[model samples]
Target: MSKVVLVTGASSGIGKAIATFLSEKGYKVYGTSRNPKNIEDFNFKLIALDVLNIETITTAIASIIKLEGKIDILVNNAGIGVTGPIEETPTDEMRNAFNTNFFGAIDVIKTVLPHMRKQKSGLIINTTSIAGYMGLPFRGIYSSSKGALELVTEAIRMEVKRYGIDLVNVAPGDFATDIISRRYHTPLFDDSVYKENYKANLDLMDAHVDTGKNPIEMAEKVYKIIHTKNPKIHYKVGGFLEKFSIVLKRILPDTWFEKLLMNHYKL
Candidate 1:
């Protein structure tokens, strides 16, 4: 029997690529989005799901359980990026980022745990980012949310080990996703105060994202992790810069790393 997999945020980018790749691998796949209408691929079943909506999440998972009978893998990939200085960012905007990136993922895991626990077998993959490991300028909110997700995945992995379920975190350094184009910049702050600072950093981020790895590359890494007999707690995917960033984070002094980032982006 083919393994059953459910992926959220499947409308485009890495989520879409992962859904397509998994389906092609013969897994019984269900891809979800905020609206079923946004789903263009007819290859996999489209389910309406907004991670912030608990009712919608519950309903979607219930329906999937009813139809598929079991879920072999759950990919928590639904998230939004918010860019702004921490002090300039509104509290509400930070809450919204957490709601989608952290709480929303927890909601899905809570809903699916019972099924996976009963089956005593399943894999949960959380789509985190390199930002989770190290904070970046103008990405405080996004980084905080992903950092929270990283911790949640770690805790869940250890807790669910006895239940025969696995939790894995996939932290892509900088993928060529529409996340940058679709990013929400909170304007609640005094733009005039940090306009130049914000613009400089945001521009650099946009440029880096444009030249990042293809979403298909990330999807392939995800596919491999899912099929591994014993996947690691965390997997990093990206270019040489990504690996270097991780190494720098480990070996460099805090002030030095900060200087490096500021100097590199001319921020």
Candidate 2:
């Protein structure tokens, strides 16, 4: 029997790429989009889901279980990007970002964990970002939310280890995705002192994503992760610069790393 795979936020980008690729490889793939209409011409099954809504997530999982009997894998890939300075970003705005990017993943994970635990075997892959590890100039909210997930992933690994379930954190660098279209920039930036520099820096961030790596490459990396008998705890997906930045951050002095990051964003 083919393994059942449920990929959230599969309407486009990395989520869509992973769903499409895995379905082609013979997994019984079910992809989620907030609106079924946006799923378009996809070979996999489409489920209506709003990751920020717990009830919708419950319904989606129930539907999948009703047909597939068991979920072999759950990919937590639904997230929104938020940008702006740390101080200028409203508290509510940051909470909203956490709701969608961090808590939403947790909601889905909590919903499906029982099924995986019952089966005594499963894989959980969380789609994090390079920004999750290092706080970017204007992407503080996005970074912190994903960074929260990064910490959760680490602890969840130990908790799920006894259940024969695996959890992985894949930090993707800038990928050519609709994330740019979907990103939310804080309105407060307009009235702040960092206006000029922030706008220029934000544009620079978008430019990198505009010419970023392909989503298919990320799908390929995920595919390998799914199939590995005992995959590593963490995987970084993106170019050499993206992956190496983490290492440099690890080994380089704090001031040096800050200088490099500031230079990259032209801050």
Task: List the candidates' TM-scores in order.
Answer: 0.95, 0.97
| TM-score of candidate 1 against the unseen true structure | 0.95
Worst 10 residues of 2 by lDDT: 183-192
Top TM-score model: 2
TM-score of 2: 0.97
Candidate 2 lDDT by residue in tens digits, 67-126: 989999999999998888888887888888899989999999999999999999999999
| Residue 58, model 2, lDDT | 96
Model 1, 1-267: lDDT tens per residue? Answer: 899999999888899899988888898889899978745555688799999999999999999889878999999999999998788778988899999999999999999999999999999999999888888778988998999999989998999899999999999887788887668885634446778778878777888888888899878998899879999998888888877798998999999999998887677
Q: Candidate 2, which segments miss by more than 4 Å at Cα? A: 38-40, 188-191
On lDDT, the candidate that comes out on top is 2
Model 1: lowest-lDDT 10 consecutive positions: 186-195
